[model samples]
Target: MRLSNRNNKPLFSFIYSLVGIIFILGVIAYVLEISKFDVFGKKAWILLAIPSLLFLLLYILGRPVFEYDSDGEALNFRNNHILYILARKDAKDEFPKYKLLKFNIINVFVFKRLYVYILSKKNHIVILKYDINYLSKKQIKDLKFSLNKVVKANKEIRHEHEDNTVAV
Candidate 1:
């Protein structure tokens, strides 16, 4: 899916911007606290340091963006960089689009708080997340439609295979 500018996210942008402002102020406070002046008290360290640490955590993991393609769904999980296909356990189809043919066309869907990565039969399976507020109303609906259609197809095809099951 197309991701607009990061600054367009209202709450996310506000929180990140607040974190930056707090961090800069915290640095200034630390310098003042250790300077030759008595402007900052011992309690200044606790006050500034505590919230700064908390907000730093928020700044790091609060917003995540995923890019999907035939290669794999890409994301930074923790400190590890990951890119791979996770086939669905329930779908027993062995062929599973054995080539990169499906990778050329990847679909993005929005469900509740999720960014569904509907990567056709060949690209394996993946899903994702991001705020819809960063997109227009039309974009949101289009994403939702794409995801729902793929999910429905997944159900029908999987069910058909199940009914034709054979014993080894």
Candidate 2:
């Protein structure tokens, strides 16, 4: 199943709006600082502007144009111009297993964000946080399906191995 951000207009629009807001705020801050002749404030405003501009540019330029085949051969993210050749066998071996699952949906006051979490075997926790407002429904659904499948498959395989060992 190949999936890409080819037709996610809503996501694109949301991101554009966000970046636009950031840029507008930056510009306003810069103007205010300049009007007041505060060198430090102006510098800070410019610094803030940099990330907003970079994110906006990247969203426009690095939008996923292609996706990987189901066989996990290669991934062409951002654009078909950049190919990420994956050694499927080697990559699968590096997959992480979750020791525990615990998370809460918290709304971020600033960006209104929601995040997920998973506890690792090494006593470390992993957070699955992202700007969901900037993602299409299709993208979100596909990601959920993929993650569930991976977790299910991993659990089943582990159980099978354990059962086999016990029978020995």
Candidate 3:
């Protein structure tokens, strides 16, 4: 199965553009005396500060475009800022299914992360993290279902192997 937020690009773009326009209009209104309100005359800084703060807040909390694929023997995941190069945080990873030991989902405030535990060739446990903030509730459920299947299969196989081995 494959999941992605690529189809929501237009909605994201519209929100960004709306915020930008609000900021520009606020600046113009303050400079051109378009409003007769006393706040604009005496506390003009409010106009500048409000929109600036809003843009910064949105940037910090903005969701990234996310993708997950579990089509073959490996699971693939990716995350890139919806605004593209404006934010340089992008991640991509692929790991085989057989090595997967377990997985976890962490949600705090507006942020979410998926932690995958895998067994390395050297018998060390490796932890992989992926951003899952952009995924919807249903998408997250689906992802959890997929990971659970793999982890369960891995555990059952290990148990079968253990049952076949005898103490020497």
Candidate 4:
């Protein structure tokens, strides 16, 4: 499966835009206050400009990006300058016989976490916790799909083996 980049959450984009607006307003307020001073007004403006510029830079560059391709056998995640590569084999090894039951975005404090639940054929359950920043929303969903498919295929193979043994 290939996921397109057009499916980003609109709410997050709105919030980021709001934060940029607030930073710009703060810069304007500081400049206006400094102009009231007779001397050293430029210094106050400079101080305000420094942080405002930094905030804008961070807001633009910190957005999450994701790429998922089942045929390629790996999921690629990029946030800012950090990159994470998760191979299909690695994920299969980790969960083994568990099937992905459900997943969602859960908020904790200042961060968003992804909570994934998996059910094993033996009735055992496994919960996987991942920070949302580690992967894009689309990548998360695609990974879940891939994992579930693998689990089901493995289970079918096991069932066929058991049936053959019983017939013999």
Residue 107 lDDT in model 1? 32
Q: Number of the top candidate by lDDT?
A: 3
Candidate that would win on TM-score: 3
Off by over 4 Å in 4: 6-21, 34-62, 78-110, 113-143, 151-168
lDDT of 4 by residue, 1-168 (tens): 654343454554565566667777767777667666535554566656766775654443333433334344333322222212211111212343325455566654445555556676687776655444535556666766775675566578778989999999
Per-residue lDDT tens digits for candidate 1, residues 87-160, read 11111111222211211222345222333343555556654333333345665465555445445656776667
lDDT of candidate 3 over 38-62, digit per residue (tens): 5456677777888888788666654
Q: State the lDDT at 46 in candidate 1.
A: 69
Model 4: how far residue 16 lies from native, Å: 5.6
List where candidate 2 sits over 4 angstroms from the true fold. Answer: 6-70, 73-131
lDDT score, candidate 4: 0.52
TM-scores, all models, native as reference: 0.42, 0.39, 0.76, 0.36
Sequence-dependent TM-score of model 2: 0.39
- Candidate order by lDDT, decreasing, is 3, 4, 2, 1
Give candidate 1's whole-model lDDT.
Answer: 0.42
- TM-score: which is higher, 1 or 2? 1
lDDT of 3 at 119: 92
Candidates ranked, most accurate by TM-score first: 3, 1, 2, 4
Q: How big is the RMSD of model 1? A: 10.5
